[model samples]
Target: MNEQEKSDGIKRVIPARYNRLMTDPLLREIVSGLDGVAEALAAKQQANVLFDELGTPPPDYAREAAGFIGSGKVDKDWIGRVAKDELAKLVRAEQRKHVSDLINGCLTQLDSIAEYSVDDVLAELDTRLQELVQPLYAAGEKLTGVDTPTDAIRRGLTEEWRLFADAAIEYAKIRAAQKIAVSVAPEEFKDRGQSAACEDPHANSSVIANIAEVWESWNTPPQAELAWSDNDEGDRVARWVRPRVEAPWPVQTDEFLLWCIRNDAELRVPDLGQM
Candidate 1:
């Protein structure tokens, strides 16, 4: 690229990088605990018992006649009945323990992949991004306009946040990095020798440019439902079109726009445009 292009590219960054500021160490722990409990419940074992009748007793009429004579002795066993009840209780207890172990296993295994994966990249990106972004929330209210606290501080934070986010998005798009035990490159790559090429600043710069372009392009279409009429020589026609926004950009807008953009599909189309 030309020197001017390269210079401009070097100056761009993405907003997602600032999101790392919101990272909470305790959040993962809580999720892991919940997962452990869910797994424990899911892995429970069950116990059952079956009763067998040794033989059928004689018919009521036959037994009644024989009861008066009393020629034979009645024999029954209590040991078998007692043993069955005890076995069932013991089996149930064992099953409960087995289920508990399963839950513990799930808790331990939550999001702990040995190699690089989408989740791993996403988690890193989320945590890092939040860490960089959370500082912007200086007031009690949610983030609205860019003007807040001190302008110089805000600008510096914004720049760094964009840079980090841009780098992360570019890294994720590569896709090849999602391999076994692959170590992601550092944020600022340093050339070690003649064998390696210089870091591609344009890679991130291009992504940021695209993001800005799409945002501006999408914004060009007014979201408000406008009411206007066309007058023909002998007829009058009136119509209105309701606007809608779909995924991807909507996600980005909601995340970065402080929910100022439509969320939960609830919008106010006032007759006079008042809140």
Candidate 2:
């Protein structure tokens, strides 16, 4: 792709302005805090559900109470313990409201973020996405430097590393769907632009194949004819690298992927013009 085309591709995945916005510390803090709030709320809900099921007393207490009423047998201590348990459960139930309030606080924070520019949130998203791919990008750079480039070894090694980058890029996009409101799709190779000729020293057949596989895996299903590679080639490579999402809130998958691809492209191939 030409510089403009490459840039456009990057923008399509992650708009430059928005990608920058993601880096804002304030935005990231809000997202992290909100996710924590959500988790606390979920915990409270679990406790409430348990309280509702267990009721005012444990089963043993209820049975004893029944026996006392039926057979003139009374155990005050058992009743007291049951009452204590029931009170404990009620306290937990009451705490559920507190959880609800905390969640509301998070929603309020999210609403506050809504007032901010799309660019800022997007920038944060981009940063997180880059984090996800960093391990693979570093690995790819490292391996490319260390490996002896034979046709077989070249394909096996480089492509495998690239796959890590690709998978990380793809999965980040998929994950972004839950955070942002926008719809973003992973970029695909609709048509092969150029074949890596046998004489091309820089091109590895494995890399080329995995590139196609990367595109296909995003678009296709696990049961579909095209899926992630599972060969000795596949085993040596990871399907996806983890990208850190700045925001805890889930975003639209496509936009997330776009940002990830744009951010990761340079790392994967330094020569943007040629890529």
Candidate 3:
């Protein structure tokens, strides 16, 4: 078929394939489950059971159940029923946990799939394949003393086939890397002060100073007068302060510094020492 004919055929086939995909039950389930709608429904059913037992509507069930549990009017039969129901809940929670884990795995796979763009992959393939075949085309022209339509077509096909083989090999490598990335925890890949340092290499000293300042501020003891206060004794004094140097940066600077300290990066705040 000619190029236009082939293009037209692809256009028609793609829409039909898309329609079929959209109508697929599995795909519909996946799309709906992306927002945890199914999990919400299951939770709602559990809530309904609790509502019925409490003899109250869903909205008022929580208060009613709390009162029922706290009241001193409980008998042996009530205690046994509650215990039985609690055991049933524990069993159901264990089963749901297994299903939740499986769903999470599927969601992670979908995220990875979504990360790749078909157009981008196709473009890269085309570019790399062209680069791979250029030398072959040049060699063919040199051997023939002059380029011809037949020579060009043969060289193109040779390059295309070689590209296909190379693509398969590259695809395997990509899959391996993706698997490794998935297997590794995100926190494991996190660098200490590297992100802050990389954000502005020219202002490394300022960045380090700011990070140290924030860290010290977080761990510093409250003033003597403030120490006696209740608010200062809690999270009030422990609240994170964003580093001045990394202010314009998107990430949480204090958290990044903490990660750096935890990972034991070479970062040091002159007077502050190791951290």
Candidate 4:
């Protein structure tokens, strides 16, 4: 890293790293990858419930993994039902919270069955490998020389973690921290993070609402603001005759999120849950 000098004339603290991350390409990729991973995991969980109903274990999460990348979409209809199935899986003594969630209409725990979770699969693979190797060890064979399944999985995860950490550190070093969070999300992961509207009003109305609220909080249109100044009372003084800002940065952000929410579908599910 090149040694950079700070200006000696200033000592103001700012969220330099956070500010830079807001527009960092690598950060965007990692964040998108994370959302994709999370949704896949949720899908895998839903698939497991289906497999349990079929009295079988999913083979390498084939059904879930394929569907997630294929025509997988969040089935709002089955959201409650799938969650109920999962809740039923718990032992009689351990389902208190989940049961409450179901009855209260908070299906937040049960949803989106389309993709598979890498961590879940890796963990399961490690478990199965241990089950296979345990017997061999019982017969006096030394487990050595080759990377065990668990070791291999851990090794891969560790490397990925290192890479992610490195990217974040590099970003922080080069950029400044700023905001707590942003609403930006990649396609297939609309409105998955902080509060932000989708680009399309139909995709996420809350996005429009959010942007509108911010813009009109002062009674101005979404794409522009009225001119104003402070009065003797230390409050904003109206300046109606000033020019308006057409299509500000926030509007651009709204468009970005809306496009993502609209196109970020895995598979369109019927709105039959209303039934």
Q: Which candidate number has the best lDDT?
A: 2
lDDT of 3 by residue, 71-176 (tens): 9554557556666766776665555444444433443443433233222322333344335334433333333322333443565544533433454354333323
Look at candidate 4 and tell me the lDDT of residue 181: 20
Q: Mind giving the per-residue lDDT tens digits that candidate 2 earns over 1-275?
A: 11122321211122332233244444445343433435544654564465345343234556767778898868758767887877886785555445444434444443444434333434454455456555654445445333333432555665545455465455544234223322111223212233322222112221132334333332222232323556765574336433321321114432333333433422221111122
**Model 1, which residues run further than 4 Å from truth?**
1-81, 111-275
lDDT of 4: 0.32
Question: Lowest lDDT 10-mer window, candidate 2?
Answer: 266-275
For each candidate in turn, the TM-score is: 0.22, 0.26, 0.22, 0.15
Candidate 1: worst 10 consecutive residues by lDDT? 46-55
> What is residue 190's positional error in candidate 1, in angstroms?
19
RMSD of each: 23.7, 19.0, 24.2, 29.1
Better of 1 and 4 by TM-score: 1
User: What is the lDDT for 247 in model 3?
Assistant: 34
lDDT of 3 at 205: 35
Please name the candidate that would achieve the greatest TM-score relative to the true structure.
Answer: 2
Give each model's clash number: 16, 31, 1, 25
RMSD of 1: 23.7
Give the lowest summed-lDDT range of ten residues in model 4: 266-275
The sequence of per-residue lDDT tens digits that candidate 1 reaches over residues 1-275 is 01112221222112121112113333233232332334432442221111011112222344544654685653344335446745765664555444434433432333232211323443443454345334333421332343332432565555533443454453343322211112222322222111111132221211232332333333234445766676777566656765554323223322332232222211111111110
Error of 1 at 223 (Å): 61
Tens-digit lDDT track of model 4 for 114-153: 1122233223323433343233332211222223334434
TM-score of 1: 0.22
